[model samples]
Target: MPSIAGTYKHYKNENFDEYFSAVGVPYMGRKMMGLSSPQMDITVDGDQMTIKTSSLMRKVEYTFKLGEEYEEHMPDTVLKCVTKIQNDNEIITESVIPATGEKCGRHYLFTDDECVITLTHDKAKVPAKRYFKRVTS
Candidate 1:
């Protein structure tokens, strides 16, 4: 698998507002998220990984073993999540909210200089894409 342990700063997004709305984020939270530029830092050690996402308005962090289901603490809610790697260069995280039965996913495709994140929710009309540039390798 490709190692994606790096620091990245978000630069652009597409359909994020709609994606957040579909995922049940409130208007104010979505607005603040839209205005904030998020930075994600990924760290991997053996079979475990941690991803820290931070922005001006919010910050979320997850540490889990690869391929193991764990509780993902999101800004709006908590979810049961499983993270896996695909195509050697992509890391995918799928989540389900037990209380509401809501589902969402995040995919991180990484390269030497950039990382592209794709956000998906079953209720969304379209997927959202966030682009990030690597700050540290």
Candidate 2:
């Protein structure tokens, strides 16, 4: 498995607004997210990993292990989440709201200098893609 331990800065996105809307993010929140550039830092230590996402408007951090369930506090709702590694350079995360049965997921594909993330909601067939370049400094 590829070690995904680095900082990445967002550069581009595709269909993020629509995906956010489908997941119940308010218009103003979506607008702010669209206008802001976010950075993600990931650290891997054996079977545990920590992921931190930050932007001008919001920031959050999460620590979890592969194939384990954890509580994920999102902007809209809290979800029970699980993560898995798909291949040498890809990781998949699935989250669901127990009270509402709402489901969402993210797929991260890493290259030498960039990571492409895909966001998906169970209610929406179309997914969104975000591109992040590694921060070498």
Candidate 3:
């Protein structure tokens, strides 16, 4: 996989609001989440990886080793998940909600200057994509 170690700022989203609604997020909250842009900082160190996402409302950090399970607290829920590197340029994370038996995942594909994130939930009709641009400073 590519070394996705940089700060990526959210630039655009496709189907995010609808995805949020399908996942039972309130209308007002979905609207707010859709409007605000977030920044994600990813660090790769040998077999370990750390990712931190920050926005106007919240900041969350997750660290895990490739092919290992870890506790992740997402914006809305907390779950145990395994993260894996794939396709030489992609990171895939999968989680299952025990209470609801719902499966969800995220795919992060990196290019030279951009990251495309696809969010998937088994209950939702389709996945949502969030695009981020590399920040050079």
Candidate 4:
């Protein structure tokens, strides 16, 4: 299995706008997010994992222990979330939106070349995927 700790840059996304819309983000917010190129730095220390995401809009960091539930406060909303790894191959994050009371999921598959993030919402017709290339330097 590939190591999950790495620095990654977002290069492309599929159905990004639609996914944001289904998640209740407004048009302008979605547009801004679409235009931003974010970088994610993931690190693991013992049983805890920290993910820091930075972009033009803002930077947010999340730290959680594997298979443990936590409260994540986002810019627009709050989520009840749990993150875990599957067979050491994929990082899975499951969350519940407080406002909508809807369940969502995010899957992160890591490889030597890149990491692909798959986002799924209860209200969305299909899942959205974001591609991020690993920064080897």
* Predicted model with the maximum TM-score: 4
Q: Candidate 3 clash total? A: 0
lDDT of each residue in 31-107, candidate 4, tens digit only: 99988989999998888999899998899999999999998887778899999988776999999998789999899
Residue 80 of candidate 4: its Cα lDDT? 99
Residue 1 CA displacement from its true place in model 2, Å: 7.4
Sliding window of 10 residues with minimal summed lDDT for model 2: 1-10
Per-residue lDDT of 1-137 in model 1, one digit per residue for the tens?
44599999999889989988987789988888888888999998988999999987778888999999999766557889999977878999999989889788899999888999999888998999999999997
Q: Which candidate comes out best when scored by lDDT?
A: 4
Q: Write the per-residue lDDT of candidate 2 for residues 1-137, one digit (tens) a residue.
A: 44578999999999989988887788998888888889999988777988899997889999999889999986657899999877768889999889889888899999888999999888676899999999942
Off by more than 4 A, model 2: none
Question: Which pairs clash in the backbone of model 4?
Answer: none
Give the per-residue lDDT of model 3 (tens digit) for 1-137: 44578899999999998898898889999888898899999988888999998999888898899999898875577787999888768999999876788999999999888899999998789899999998841
What's the distance in Å from true for residue 121, model 4?
0.8
lDDT of 4 at 4: 88
lDDT of 1: 0.88
The per-model lDDT (C-alpha) reads 0.88, 0.87, 0.88, 0.90
TM-score result, candidate 3? 0.93
Summing lDDT over every window of 10 consecutive residues in candidate 1, give the lowest-scoring window: 72-81
